[model samples]
Target: MKKRAAFLIGTGCVLIAVSASLAVNNQLESLKAEKSAELLTEAFISRTTVFETSVTEMTNEPVPEIIADNEIRGADEQASAKKPIIIDGQEFIGLLSIPSLGVSLPVNNDISYPLLKMTPCRYFGSVDSDSLIIAAHNYNSHFGKIGMLKPGDRVNFTNAGGLIETYAIAEVLTLPGDAVDEMIKPEGWALTLFTCTYSGTERITVRCVKEERI
Candidate 1:
C-alpha cells in the first residue's frame, strides 16, 4: 500500500510541473504579440503621420513645368519659374506620402556618417546620389508594430517642388546593435527607413525600391 501511495504522489507532482510549463509558454507568446503591436503604434505617430502631412501640403505648391516633365533636369530645374514652398525651414514644401505606413510627411536627405538626430528620408540631397535614406526613433509605446511590418509595403516622399515620389518596400531586416551596413548599402536609389527593434537591442531596417518619379 505504501509503494502505491508513493507512486501516486510522484505522478501528481509531474502533472503539476507540466501544467506550469504550459502556462509559462502561453504567457511568453502573448507577451511577444503585445510588444509587436506597441512598436507599430509608436512608428505610426512619429514617422508615418508626419510624412503624410508633409506630402499633402507640398502638393498644393506650383510645380515647375520644366522639371515636372523631366526627371533629370539640370539647367531647366534651376531655371524653372516655380520653386518649392516651405515654412520655418522645418516644413518640407515638396514631399511624398505613403498611405500604407501612415506616413505623409516631408523627406529630407541624411547619410549614416556624422549621424544627426533628425534625418529626412525623402530628398535625394544630390540628384546624383544613391538612395534616399532616413531614420526615426523607435519607441516602445508602438508595441512592436513597426517590427511586424513586412517587405513590399508602399512608401512615398515628395519634394518641395511638388514632385511626387513613390517606392515599394524591398526588405525589412533586424540586426544586432552596432551593425549598420545592410542599412547603409551603396546601391541605387533605395529608400531606407530604420529604427530600434524591441528595446533597441536589434536595429530594424527598411529598404524600398523607387517606383515612380513624378
Candidate 2:
C-alpha cells in the first residue's frame, strides 16, 4: 500500500511538472508575439515620418537630376531620392507593408541576430532589382503567417524617400530548408519575403512583382 501511494504521488508530481512547462511555453510565445507586433508598429511610424518629411522637402526643391545613359537607374534613383533613417545608429533602408498580414516593418540592409528580431531585414539583393529578397523570423507575429497570403494579394514597399510601390503576390512557395542559397539568388522575382516553416524543414517564400508606383 505504501509503494502504491508513493507511485501515485510520483505520477502526480510528473503531471504537475508537465503542466508547468506547458504554461511557461505558452506564456513565452504570447510575449514574443506581442513584442514582434510592437516592433513592427514602431518601425512603421518611424518610416512614415521620414517619408513625409522627404516629400515635403521635395515639393520645395527642383526636380532631381537626369540619369545618364547606360546607368543602372533603379538603385541610383533610390539612393539619390532620400537620406536614410538613423535610429540608434542603425540605418533603415526602406519600409515593407502587407495589409493582409497586418505587418508594416522597417527594412534594414543588415540581418544581424538581434536586429532581425526587431524587424524584417533585406537579406540579399536590392529592392531596386527584380530579385530583391527580404527575410525575417517566423515569429507568431512576424512572417510566420506569410503562407496565408494568396496570389493577387497586395504588398507595398516604401523607399527611404517616401516613394511607395505596390506589388501583387505572384507565388507562394515552400522550398527545401537547405535551399537558402538558391532562395536568395532569385531569378526574376521583383520582391521576395521568406521565413522558416513551422517544422524548420522548409522555407516559405512569398514572391511579388511591381503593380503600381506612387
By TM-score, the best candidate is: 2
lDDT of 2: 0.71
* Cα lDDT, model 2, residue 152: 95
Relative to the true structure, how large is the alpha-carbon lDDT of every model?
Answer: 0.49, 0.71
The TM-scores, one per candidate, come to 0.51, 0.72
Model 2: per-residue Cα lDDT over 1-214, one tens digit each: 9999999999999999999998798568656755864765465455553354322222223212221111444676556544556666677777777877776667776888777767778888876676778888787566878999999988877676566667789999999978877786658778999998878889899999888655
- Candidate 1 deviant stretches above 4 angstroms: 1-96, 108-128, 139-145
lDDT of 1 by residue, 80-140 (tens): 3124343334333234344554534333333332122232333233322536556554422
